[model samples]
Every structure is written in structure tokens, then in C-alpha cells.
Target: MELKVDVLLTSPQERAYHTAKDIAKLQSLNGTAPMLRNCEGLRSRSLGDWEGRLAAEVRGTPSPPDAEPLGDLMQRGSLGQLLPSCYAAQLLPVPLMVEENAVWNGYYRE
Candidate 1:
């Protein structure tokens, strides 16, 4: 199956940007590459005080008081200003989940 990209929207984070760039490059291999645009709303949710803590330490704890709510983050992705009109876009910050899980299973194993 071929995926068609009109515009490649990405988070400003290094990892996300790089992954998007690589995709853009692959698209170029076949035809004109899609334009890459950084979308702030695509960035990972801020975990507040849990930002840099080990995964095991934060796994079962309550969300931090200052953390951004998941609903708010979802709303941001749908905001008119953040996304172009009549375009296909789905914001999934899988990296956020992967990072913690990878840390738990790889680095902070019990």
C-alpha cells in the first residue's frame, strides 16, 4: 500500500523531526517529497514533575498537578490554527508511551 502525503507535519522534538525527515526522504525516492512542517501540538505531553524521573518511579503514581491533560492535548491537535483545512492528520504521540515503556523494560528493569 502506498501512503500519500500532502504535507508532513511533525513535532519539533529531535526524534520526531528526524523520523519525519526520513519519511520525507523516502517519499522523494518515488516522487516529489512532501513539505515538512513542525507542529507544536504534535509534541509530547508535558509530564510536569515526572518529566525526567525513572519510569518505575512514576508508573503507579498519580499524574502530576502541573501536567497537561490528555484532553487538552487532543484539543490542541484539532485546533484550526494548528492543522490545515481539509487535510488528513492524526496526532499520535507514540514516542511518549514508548519512551517510558522502553526505560522500564530496558534501563530500569526490576
Candidate 2:
């Protein structure tokens, strides 16, 4: 499906930015590509000292002592947290999500 996207806000990571650029290529406003911006706060969870470590290698490694908690990510789009709590407002995670399309929307009903 095609979407009329005027702007795209992505995390500061290179992969995220690249993905946004790819998506923007498919989006348009009056035949113009969407604008893209990198947001630092929107970055994925920082692995801190755990960067480059394999999950299997550290399955019981206790994680980095300085790593941030996963719950902090919920704050970005949920209750009073640091992630802005506007993920849904931004129409983020957008549409065409397989889990959403095939599982959540496919099974649940009001």
C-alpha cells in the first residue's frame, strides 16, 4: 500500500536512518519525497558496556552493570517516562506490521 508521508522521524542510528530513507522513497506528498530527521532520544536501547556481546554468550551473563532497563523504553511511548510517550501519536511503527495484521488484528475483536 502507498502512503502520503510528508515527514519521517527516525532514531539516530545509521541502520534506522537508512531504513527511513528507504521508506521515504516509497512515500510522497504531491510527488515529493518525505522529509527525514534523526532523533537522538528515539534511539534504540543502548547496550552500554554490553555492545558487541553475543546474546548466547551472555544468556546468563547478567548484562552490563550499567545497561539501562528495558522498562525505560516503555516510557518513550507509554506512561511518564523519557521516550516522549508519543509513539502512537506519531503513527509510528506505522502499518503493515505482520504481527499486527496477522495476529492482533486478525484475532482480537471489540
Candidate 3:
């Protein structure tokens, strides 16, 4: 079956943005490709002082002073305010998906 998309939401990071851009090229909504919207909420967590360090080196160490907390990450990633409005507007998903759509990647709900 042909795929459809109403909206393509992605993290502002280069990788996610490019991936979504590629997917947007292959899908269409109302005969037009959807635009890639950069959602800061979808961004990878900020690691602060630990950002450039190797995982092996930082694995068991205490969190850096500026590291984002897991709870904060979850809250931001949830996109609670954004989701309901998008759902109400009947937006489909790329990464953050709606339940009825079968193309879940990292789609968040609630």
C-alpha cells in the first residue's frame, strides 16, 4: 500500500532532520509533500560537560552539572501540548506518531 503523511516532525539535530527530509520526499499529503518541522522537543538530551566524552568513560560517573535530568527529558519529549493539537488537526507522524497510524518510529503520546 502507498504511504501517506500529513506532517513530518523531527528533532532539530542534523541526522533526524535529514532522515525526515528523505522520508518526506517519498510521501505526500493531498498530493503535496509535507514540510519538515524542526521540533526542539525531539532533540537528544543535552549532556553538558559530558557531551563529547566517550560513553565508556562517563558511564558510571556522576552526571555533569548541566546534564539534563531524565524526568525533564521525558517531559520535553512527551510533547504533551503539541500532540493533542496535532491529533485534533489530524496530523499523522514520522517519528512521533498517532495511535491509528502504523508507521511508528519514536512517536510520543501523552
Candidate 4:
């Protein structure tokens, strides 16, 4: 009987960067080599004002109606009303999952 091993591959951004570095090092050991292929179509979204802040801190304040959520701010076209260069490019995680207080109760007078 013969034994075989199967391997799975993951193309995470960090993994790709390290792999490229290792390849460069190995090539240098031998001699000058051609440039490694750069990872194309790889984009990282900016954290904006909520970068270093904790979730608990942000949720402590009441969200205003005009206040855009972290997700909308991170998106591209969402900011076009204020900036001309704004455009949607990638997806970003929501910063605040829960709000401390509801912005509107939607109650109407009879």
C-alpha cells in the first residue's frame, strides 16, 4: 500500500507577503533573480477615526441621525456627497455592532 498526503492552500494577504519575501531571500542566495509577481487586486480599507478606539467606547455615545456609521464612512461612494473622489471599492466590517440609544422611536402624534 502507498501513502499520500494532501495539502490545502490559503492566499491570505500576510501569507502572500511573507512568501514573496522568502522567495526573494532564496533567490539572492543563488544570484540576482527576476522580480517576484506583486499581489494585484489586493486592497486594505482604512480604519478612519475609529482605528485605535475600543468598541465599548464608541457604543457609549448616542448615534446622531446625520452621523454616518463606520461601514458607510469606510465605503467609497458613500462619501461622494461631501467629497468628489469618493467611490465604492471594498467591504469593511462594522465598527459598532450595538447602539447605546435608539436614534428615533418612530412615534407619531395622533
Candidate 5:
């Protein structure tokens, strides 16, 4: 598949930079190579006091009664606590499902 991109919003992270470069290459093949830049507003929110901790340790512990609620975060367009989980989802454009008894077929257009 050919993805023609006009612009790409990326973070300062190395992986994000590489991914954007690859996409720009593909776009160049089509015609114009859009500019890729980082935006501070696009950066993910900080975890505050929960930067690094296991799920078990973090759970069952109250958030000091001052932390933002999950629903509130989503309402504010932040996704806050769910950010990590959403990262993987962001890399995936579609869900890939596999079944033992299922057979799939497709055609390669390249």
C-alpha cells in the first residue's frame, strides 16, 4: 500500500523520528515529501508520582485523593492513566485476529 502524507506530527523520541522519516520516504515516491516536526502540545502527559511502578503496586493504593479520575481525564481529552495502553493501540491501525480453525486470504498489490 502507498501512503501519501502531506505532514506528519511526531514526538522527539528516536522511534517516532524514524517512523516519520520512513513515511516521508514513501511520500516522496508518490510526489511531495511533507515536513515532519515535533509539537510540545502533542506530547503525552506526565504520570506525576506514578512514573515507574508495577501494576500490582500501583493498584489498591489510593491516588492521594487528589489525582484526576480516569473518566475526568478522558473527558478532558487526556486519556491520562490509559496513555500507556493507548500507545500500543496507536501503532496499530487495525486489529489483527487469528483463530485456529479460521483461514484468511488476501492479495498482494505491490
Candidate 6:
């Protein structure tokens, strides 16, 4: 017996991992398991320290030049180097998962 496969065409954005669980349910009804493909890029911009802090606050203080002017540094470093690296990594077939809590838990497990 020859097995025939049906091609299901769907937009990568519309079928992203954000709706993976939902898509899985729908696919199951149609007798197929939903596979999540990581089309979304890395967790690029945390923008943590630079959120509301002003350059004036840390400029004249003991803070380093990079930390004092984080916005500029981020634009130069992250936008220039980091984002390009992330984009390149996204092109690869393998998926990169960032496990934040796991790293911390391993370091400071009580």
C-alpha cells in the first residue's frame, strides 16, 4: 500500500509557538500532532538596567562608562553584534531554548 501525505500550508507567524498548545488541539481533531517550530528569534532586548535610569544619575558617579550610558552601549553593542548573531542562529535548524530559572536554580540550590 502506498502512503500519501497531505500538505498543510500555514503561515509561520500565525502558527508560532505562542499558540502551539492551541494549534496542537486543532491538529489533534484533524488526526495530526502539532509540531512547534521556533520561528521567533532570541530574547534579545531585556533592557533591564537602562529602563528608567537617566545618564545624569550614573554619569558623575562611580559607575562605569558602559553602565552610565547603557542606552548608547546597547544600541552599539547589542544592535550591532548581538542581534546579528541571534538572527544567524535563528536560521539554523536546531532550536535554542533559554532556561533562565534552571541556571539560577543550579547555582543557588538550597
What overall lDDT goes with each candidate model? 0.60, 0.51, 0.64, 0.33, 0.46, 0.35
**Which ranking of candidates, highest TM-score first?**
3, 1, 2, 5, 6, 4
Top-lDDT candidate index? 3
User: Which candidate comes out best when scored by TM-score?
Assistant: 3
Models ranked on lDDT: 3, 1, 2, 5, 6, 4
What's the C-alpha lDDT at position 84 in model 5?
27
lDDT string, candidate 4, 37-72, tens digits:
322222233345655678787776665454555566
lDDT of 4 at 85: 28
lDDT of 5 by residue, 53-90 (tens): 67687888767454556555444333332222324334
Candidate 3 local Cα displacement, residue 101, angstroms: 19
Stretches of candidate 5 exceeding 4 Å from the true structure: 1-3, 64-110
Per-residue lDDT of candidate 3, residues 1-110 (tens digit) = 66566577776677777777777776753377876666666677889999989999999999998999988877866657445534545444543332211224444434
* Count of steric clashes across candidates, in order: 0, 2, 3, 3, 0, 0
lDDT of 5: 0.46
After superposition, candidate 1 runs with Cα above 4 Å error: 78-110
Please give the lDDT score at residue 35 for candidate 2: 67
Worst 10 residues of 2 by lDDT: 97-106
Poorly placed runs, candidate 3 (over 4 Å): 28-30, 79-110
